[model samples]
Target: MKRNLLILITAAALLISGCATGPTVTRTASDEVIDLSGRWNDTDSRLTAEAMVSSMLSGGWLERFSTDEGRPPVVIVGSVRNKSSEHIDAETFIKDIERELINSGRVTFVAAGAARDELRDEREDQQSNATQSTAAALAAETGADYMMQGVITSQTDAIQGKRATLYKVDMELIGLENNQKVWIDTKEIKKLVEQKKNSW
Candidate 1:
């Protein structure tokens, strides 16, 4: 019947309209600061790295090490543990610090952790595949004079659609030879987020 066809067509149109389409995405600059969820993000990582680098390079540790060693102190970036509630990629923060240190020319950096394993594997591969002249010598890699390690912790409080988070990042530089802690620093970031209750 004509009435049945009309109902069927109306239902199909409503179902099609209710279906969700693809997401809308907008590109932004890499360095531009943006916070959507009030959680940790690239801006936080970048700012923390900048603050840490500034504090570390301006401290007396680098000078004392260079004075005693007669060369820039070699550094290896160790683990940066994330102890926060939310999942965070600590590698990005660690890489940022390493990049700054290398660019500053204040210290030399050597690979650590998995990266060291990869480098060693490549050296082993070269032992048999390449000529002696072109192959890198084993046990000739520079040893780190110091190790940099740190942890990131966070606390959150929420009540009545309002929430606040505090993040603390603690870092230290330790001498590999004597196990002396040369430098220590902490950076803190706080954010507040609020939501409104539906009035409908």
Candidate 2:
């Protein structure tokens, strides 16, 4: 009986001590400070955009637009071919170009294939309903004067557990009416990563 009472008393004391200890608070590195030491996504995007802009300006596309006697340039983004092994969002890259072009206030963007298809279908349906006299007037018709397209290629080389990744993105703005190339740009990004073997 005495031993049972002592055990119970010890258990109660331990429980009380544990309760008084309260919840543990762990301290680690603050997430607010972003660590970009190894990551090059932001840098790569900026560099790619800058390179694209430089390529366009130096290629005389801007100069042509300014001097050539024609209507305002309306560029439509066409297919962006991805030749890389890994799946990538090519539309994001095209959108980046579109955004920069819009922000620059130099060019106009016509709806791409997807948007144009939807709009065409909508117009056809409206015309069938006969609510409007002509679909031409009912729909805003804007054919793309220039088509923007690109291709992304990737290369990998590994030796002795060290790997290198190279991505080359090339884009061009072609005159749709005359099939003439007006603007061309290419951006190359290379990265090296060391591989570590797992010991199990």
Could you tell me every candidate's TM-score relative to the true structure? Answer: 0.88, 0.69
User: What's the CA error at residue 124 for candidate 1, in Å?
Assistant: 0.9
TM-score: model 1 vs. ground truth: 0.88
Give the poorly placed runs of model 2, Cα more than 4 Å off. Answer: 1-47, 128-139, 198-200
How many clashes would you count in candidate 1? 0
For candidate 1, the lDDT comes to 0.92
Candidate 2, 10-125: lDDT as tens digits: 99999998878566886755423332322335445555766785566566666677678564577788888889856767766667777666666666777787777897788777
The number of the candidate with the highest TM-score is: 1
> Model 1, range 1-200, lDDT digits (tens) per residue?
99999999999999998895889999989999899888999999989998998898888988887898799999999999999999999999999998888898888889899989999999999999999999988999999999999999999998877889999999999999999998899999999988787111
Which clashing pairs does model 1 show? none
